[model samples]
Target: MNAITKDVEMEQQREDRRVEMAQAKDKEDARERERRWQESHQPRDNLAPRWREVAGRDNWVGMLDPFDPLLRAELIRYGEFAQACYDAFDFDPYSRYCGGCKYSRRSFFQSLDMANAGYEVTRYLYATSNVKLPNFSRRSKRNNAWSDSANWIGYIAVSDDATTVLLGRRDIVVCWRGTVTQLEFIADIVNFNQPIYAEGIPTPDRSVKVAAGFVNLYTDKDTNCRFSKYSARDQLLAEVRRQVLRYAEERGEEVSISITGHSLGGALATLSAYDLAEEREVPVTVYSFAGPRLGNEPFKERFEEILGLKSLRVVNVHDAVPKVPGLIINENVPEFVRRAGAAMPWSYCHVGVKLALDHKRSPFLKDTAEASCFHNLEAYLHLLDG
Candidate 1:
């Protein structure tokens, strides 16, 4: 009886020890998994102090809450006026007093009604230029005639009460005045694989490369393309810079500058805001509508580093343009096909805070099917109206 009891007691003690050992092992494994997850998710120590400072304040999450009703109304108002600048340049019979023109005046009043604030369009910047069109049907044809491109236009206005200056650029309009002028959608792929160095600042060790097409769209025409007759980017930026400087000097006070555009114009606005902010050392805010991806990851990082919390990219949930030149692509294509020539990058990303508005029901969320209608500036305006 003593031996049997002793054996039973020994077996119970061994089982208890085994259970304790298993629990300890499980705890250690859980801790190790957590450590790995934290290491991957936390911000790296190698980030520049400036980047850290700004990115810390930024909301990196996917979707942000809608702006307050008052602010949203003001932004939409500005956006409409910006679109009006394009119409004024293209359709206004008299360029002077653009605000007086039917198209521009209508937008100006619309903005006033929406904001319930005093705003005046002071200047309209218009340029007639030639843009090169890629022969998509015939890839071999390169030497095409310089088509008369009149769509590049922008406007500078001021809010009388708020004392805010607004710079607005319009998207490309499709029409036939004398000849066919289709908005160019194909990305003119060129080499843009170099670090961007600020004009006056010392070169940082790390830099990002931007897309060549976007660069050309932002850079001075003389440097961009020697053969191109029109220098819309250069002219528009110069005018903006001049007006901003003049306003600051005359008022002897800090002026708030807001740059906005839609679609292709939106890309230009992003580029312009970056350069102006860097050169002028003034806070520049950007609101782009249905804009495409501006540059690669590095370029985006640099832009965020500079603008910080000031930039906001508004996108419609159903819009297609923003998705193109997508950051992710199907990699199953043949190597030779890839090497042959693709203007866009296989992997591309977006920049700044994105506000995606989903107006339609969840069922109609196809990215490719309804892109055309969803990508329109009118669509963005309608969504912003709400």
Candidate 2:
């Protein structure tokens, strides 16, 4: 072979080795998860009476420190729902439905072999990708196939009769898909806050604002794509309103909304939870992992104090994501110090309880320099399992 051909062959060999190693890692992860699942056995219990508290009504008081078994189990359960979005997404760019869900909504859980999830997919959520943001799954969209204007972001699932009885209340879940292999979304964040009114979230407080990039994704519309004709925010709100009417208002059932996501999805969860709580009387709670701070001081105040949003953020202390956007001016700064930039758009704050975990303490996870592994959803579940 010529010198150029020889170099190409060597590069192919290295790439093959990397793929092989990644496959091995996947197998090891699966085995580890199976082992952990076998060890942690939480028996099924009728949680109907305490469902609100389980969903964080009292802000998870007395349930986080010792990592209450029921609460931990519920968190894991919700995490799996978020994980389902990633699993069901059609990541193959060559597939005709590249940006849409791989399975029909009716068969979503069944196709994923998650028949035990006990929730039915009510609506598939879609969003028009911002021109500035990187499209992680499909770099180059093919025309006349999947609409370039849209991508399936996640889905909303409601607990069935069996699940509702087991969990103690009718639960409405919104699971926004985050990333595992693709981390381009993180590098693309604009690191600025915009007024919440831009997204049509009716807050009288002028100071309340959110990350410009996240709000754009939640509120942007694409009339060309059938899936995203309405913004993700509108789709979510309409369906939630419908579900509440059919199950709660009409049926006389106790209903609760639990929003869960990891990484970017977590920011959306927090944003949507605030929007929903602002519109209705039902209890709303957020379970997010490795999510970045999404809003400013006034936004946090309105989200938690006024809306009574119950958020449980489970993050690796080592992950860079949770400590960003407002790295210098966030809530951690002394109150007087934060007030220095309270008038600025960059002064952000996290709103809710934090469940911090250290990956270094884990014996299984590799001690890596990159934050993606630490920011991984499976990694969060593994750490939470311990």
Candidate 3:
């Protein structure tokens, strides 16, 4: 009731009000900073006109040296598309859906929390199992297994109308799943060459040979698996043809095919690109990550000079997979030496422009990480971002 006590209480109330206002102002400043950061990082829009350059039609030209922000964003985006295949795949042998996609085509993106991916899954691709089950995939040995004959290899997805408008083309994506470890991938390399024409591939040159292991992976067929009596190659060509007919020819839309993969899947992507684009009018570009040498010198020349494919292969210098299948006799040697070794079973050559990145340069990763860490698709994506 005293005047002095009332005055003290009033001053304390005013001090409390000032403290609260200061805290609120600090919180508002933090939120404003976050908004600005996010706005700066969003990918640039209206890529429709420059999509050809982004797709490497000009061999990526000036865009690659300084590493264009749009190009970097697009590369990471497609790399994530390849990573999506691994995320949506059913890997556990105990589950009945093992060696298959975990979700249907309609709900594939949604199931992976990628509802805003802006691509529609049109078809699911399957391939007869080739590599051993011990290291990579494990098919159920129980009587109630899903399919012992085949595995869900990858998928075919097309950009939606809204995305197409922004991309300047109806982009058809062929993404393949790759093995996690390099040791598992190494087990499947046969190091032998087979003429692609022998397999009824659409190519005029009979001498265009590729690794027998890859050719078998593409051409092999099994009937017991669902929606896959046709070989992976057959399924791919058929589906791409259908998409091109509907979009490019019928609908009068600009279209392009982008094939992506990692490790074994990358090798298959290269093979599929050649088969899909050779002697055809489709504009196909490959975004391969951590892929090995795909084929012989003739095979490379046939696809690039003759068929015209723009391939951008992203690789880590520390990764060992890119150096094999042609260590002794590869494109690095002299012309006469390469010609002399071209007929050998072990001779191999890579296709298209290589975008080499280094793992040591990444500050987040440890310098002593295992070999698998270096070859991981996610790791490749991180490097691409830098």
List, residue by residue over 102-219, the lDDT tens digit for candidate 2: 8999999889877667888999998875736654434325556667678889999898888788777788999998755435665565467888897788888877888888898889
Stretches of model 2 off by over 4 angstroms after superposition: 1-43, 135-141, 181-183
lDDT of 1: 0.48
Q: Name the runs in model 1 displaced over 4 angstroms.
A: 1-67, 89-117, 120-123, 126-150, 161-184, 189-206, 220-230, 306-309, 329-347, 362-370
lDDT of 2 at 79: 83
lDDT of 3: 0.82
In terms of lDDT, model 2 sits at 0.82
The 10-residue segment of model 1 with minimum total lDDT is 171-180
**Compared with the true structure, what per-residue lDDT tens digits does model 1 show for residues 143-176?**
3412222333455655553323221211111110
Ranking by TM-score: 3, 2, 1
Query: In model 3, where do residues sit more than 4 Å from their true spots?
Result: 1-43, 130-134
Deviation (Å) of 131 in candidate 2: 4.2
Per-model C-alpha RMSD? 20.6, 9.4, 4.7
The clash count of every prediction, one per candidate, is: 1, 1, 1
lDDT of each: 0.48, 0.82, 0.82
